[model samples]
Target: MKSTVEQLSPTRVKLNVEVPFEELSGDFDRAYQALAQQIRVPGFRPGKAPAKIIEARVGRQAILEQVVNDALPAKYSQALAESETNAISQPEIEVGDLVYGEPLTFSAVVDIRPEITLPDFATVSVEVDPIEISEADVEDQLEELRQRFGTLTAVERGVAEGDFVTLDLSATVDGEPVEDAATEGLSHEVGNGELIEGLDEAVTGLKAGETATFTTTLVAGEHADSEAEVTVTVQSVKVRELPEVDDEFAQLASEFDTADELREDLRRQVSDSKKYEQAGAIRDAVLESLLESVEFPLPEKVVEDEVEATQHQLVHALGHDDEQINRFLEAQGKTREEWDAEAKDEAEKSVRTQLLLDAVADEAETEVGQDELTQQIIMQAQRYGMPPQEFIQQLQNANQIGALYADVRRNKALAGVIGEVTVKDTNGDVIDTATFFGGNDDAEAEAEGDDA
Candidate 1:
């Protein structure tokens, strides 16, 4: 067997493979054995027919086809390994002349990872928003906490902002009632706008037993993207009465005993949250900078697959209803053309990022330990609301453990280079990347042991 590679482009290659008749002996044996089990002979029991008799009955073409089908995958894999090509897409195979007693020849065109020249990490600089928590921020948190513990009191007055209302809603399109759009005794916040558009304004200032009619486009279901007349009848109105901010209130809302202490704790929490946001921003900025610094051609099929998969998921999430998709796009203020363009751009960028990070991992000699892979699986499981063991089993079933390993390797590679890059805050203060992004060997070991 012999194989040679032809570079078709920066991101694609063609492989020419030739196998002598002697080299295909094993394939032939397996093909003949398989055929013996399926074909019946008068004098022989099932699966007991000789290869020569079966070949004479089934014809040489049948055996050759079976041999080609059985040998193509393994031979292609061997060829790829010999050529040292990292293919990203399935190969397009073409068979050549296949005369008896001659060599079996074939060619495969596949997409491969392009070579990328990475820039000096130390030369990259990115500025992120400074972490700042103010009194207003703490107050906002406190307000939300207060709202959670607030009591609702029935009010005889008309509905207003911040008021809760129980109402019956019905919609009609072209004088025909929409059953799915009708509901009774639905509880809603007057100004929340969690429901349909123009609902907040239509429901405001309506007293008990009063009805208000408004027009808005339906956002989901069969009638989505169509304008309808919505009638909302207020059954009752209630106002939220917030508890006074005092020591007693603090004790009820939190473990803290005093309002001042609770406020201080809230401030710390807000500051920590801001730090996380800043860290995320820094990561995004660094990745964008890295992408801009490198240039490489992306596999066209890979990008197309990514885009198609993403679009399919988006549409599926909308129940595969065209009207629902239109309404969603309208809400996002995007047209179909604009969305397609954006999806393609995003897909290209995603492919480029993955390829670049993979190269970086190779250059840095990044290795994903068993513990790190397990930790990643655990984290992803938590995000999907599944047990770690169950998620691991699912990954194994889907043969995606390699994907998880690659993700961890890429993340570690990025972390290894983050400290080399210069990071500063918007206020020009040099930030400590190691403090936030660096890995703690001791902590990681302890966590891994706990997980085990």
Candidate 2:
């Protein structure tokens, strides 16, 4: 077999292959043997029919078709390997100029991954929000602690901002009930925006017999964008009376003997949590900035394939016409082409991140302790409402070795990066996990977005 390659584009190639008479004759004989075994010729025994006799018995076209089906694949593959091409998509094959008992000529076109020049990575820098644990933050955390220990009591008066209400609710779209409508004895806080939009306003002054209806779009699963009318009635109202932040209350709530000790512990926990949040933000910023700094061409077919897969998964998970998906991708600043390109780049980045992290883990000789994995698995199982032993068994049964390995590598990589970065608070003070990542920053994020 002899092959020649032509570069069509960075992502595509054409291969011209010529197989001489010797190999062609052998393939033809094999094809005849296969055909003879499948279909018995009149007087010739099965698997013993001569090639020329089989060709005459079965039409010439049938023999040629059988030979083409059996031999074309191997011939095309040989052409690809010899021409040094790794196709991203199936090839288009065509018979070229040919001669009997001579070289069988054919050509194939295929898509391949384009060569890329990765930009310098080490010099890149990203600006992240500084971790700042303030006195107000500690106070806020202390208040949350007090609330968690608070008791709920039924109230005879009107529903107020901090009051929790048990309500019967039903929502409809256009005039029809939205899938399995009514909710019974649902406990919702009057001021909490956990329910549908305009719900708080409707529940604010309503009594057991009173009902109010308002409009809002659905937010989850299907019917996400459909305008719906939500009817809410307060079946009952209750207010949580938080215990006084005193020494006695602290002793009742926690192991701490005094309110001061409890507050101190809460402050320490909040500070530690904030540190993790800040570190995560820094990591996200760094990766995003790295992506922005790099400019390179990717294989078109790979990008397209990634795009199709992403879209299919998105549609399957979020429903076919999920406008939020479009909005989400749009918010990420992507057009179809841009998103396709980004998807393929994201695949590369993911693989590279894992590879680099694994290498770093090897260099540092890092490991995930059995106890740590056990704790993680236990926490995840509890979070997902599954039995811990069952979840662990499921993980093993499903062969999630790669997932566990990835989790370990990711933690090691982040820890490794943290070691290099000089983490600091907003006032240029040294920051640690004990002071930066635990706040309800998700609320702050939304508020910040609304303000923007």
Candidate 3:
């Protein structure tokens, strides 16, 4: 077998493949065996008919058609491997006329990964916000901690922000009571805004045993996106009294024995959190910078397929009901046209990023270790709220473990590039990416030793 590639475009190609008649021996044997089982002959058990007899019964033309159909997939795969073509979309195949003794010839047109020119890593630069922890930040964290240890006390007044209230809710749309819209003894915070829109404002300033009515849009169930008149009856109101911030309170809340020591610890925690945020910003900024510096044509089919897949996932999650999907969009204040446009834009960006990272991985020869793969699996599982073992099994069942492996390789490639690029904070201080990117550790150590 031999294959030749015809470059149709930067992102597409045509593969012309030819196989000699001698190579059809194995294909003919398998095809005959399959046909024998399907085509019954008198005085012979199933799959026991002679190949020549079956061919005669089915006609030589039929036999050749079956053989070509059975061999095209393997032949196409082999052609791709030999030609080193990275096909991103399914092929459109056409086969030429086949004579009994002539070679098999076919051609496949496919979308492929485009050739990308990578920018020099050392020339890329990005700026991120500096990590800043102020006194107010530390105090805010301490206040949240104190709230965790707070005690709720019955208040003999109107509901207010931060007040916990017990209430009963009922709603009606067009004077008809909505199904599953009535509940009693529901506990909610006055200003949380978690239950539904307009609930907080309706209940605010309302005293215990008082009721207030307001209009709100239902966000879920059959009545989603419908405006309903909701009546909320406040059963009781209570205020949370936080513990005093003192040495005794510090011992009660945390292991630290002094308030000053706890404040210092809280400051450190806030600083670490800010540093994490800064690192994420740096990574995104550097990626955006590279995206701007590099230019390449993307495979159109790849982008279109990604966009379709994203929409399909949403439709599947909504139980394949178009009405429910539209209601969901309405609740989010988005039109179907806007959603489609946004999906397409996002898909294009995602495809571009994937292509860029894949090229980087190949150029750098990035390697993903077992530990790195496991760590990535664990992180993804946590994001999806699944156990690592269960997530691995699911990935295997879907045959998506290779996709996860590719993700890890791409991440490592980007991390290596980030380490080489110039990254600075908005304050104009050079940021050490080694700590976060896990690259250039030995080099940093050597520099430290030299300084010593």
Q: Quick one: best lDDT, which candidate? A: 3
Which stretches in model 3 have alpha-carbon errors above 4 Å? Answer: 34-47, 56-63, 97-102, 330-333, 441-452
lDDT of 1 by residue, 128-163 (tens): 988887889999999999999999999988789989
> By descending TM-score, how would the candidates be arranged?
1, 3, 2
After TM-score superposition, what is the CA distance of residue 254 in candidate 3 from its true location, in Å?
Answer: 3.1
lDDT accuracy of residue 273 in candidate 2: 87
Query: What stretches of model 2 exceed 4 Å from their correct place?
Result: 17-113, 118-126, 170-179, 212-231, 244-265, 317-452
TM-scores of the models, in the given order? 0.91, 0.59, 0.89
lDDT of 3 by residue, 1-452 (tens): 99999999899899999999899989999988988899889999999999889978999988888888888899999999999999988898999998887999999999998888998888888988888778999999999999999999998888889899999999999999986999999999888778998999898899999999999888887687789999999999999999999999999989999999999999999988998898889889988998898899988888999999999999999999988898789777999999999999999999999999999999988889999999999999999999999999999999999989988899888988899999998899999998788876546789999999
Worst 10 residues of 3 by lDDT: 435-444
Q: What is the C-alpha RMSD of each candidate to the true structure, in Å?
A: 4.4, 10.8, 3.2
Ranking by lDDT: 3, 1, 2
lDDT of 2: 0.71
lDDT of 2 at 311: 67
Q: Give the alpha carbon lDDT tens digit for every residue of 1-452 in model 2.
A: 89988998877888988887688677787787778798777787789878778777887766665666678899898887777786767788888644455567888888775554433434544455675678898889878878898889887776778788898888887788876657888988777687777888877776666788888877654566678899887888888888899999889988999988988898888878876777787667654554455444455555566556666887777566557668666667777678767777776665445444544455556677778678888888999899999998889998885577657666655554444444444566654532333323434688999999
> Least accurate stretch of 10 residues (summed lDDT) in model 2?
433-442
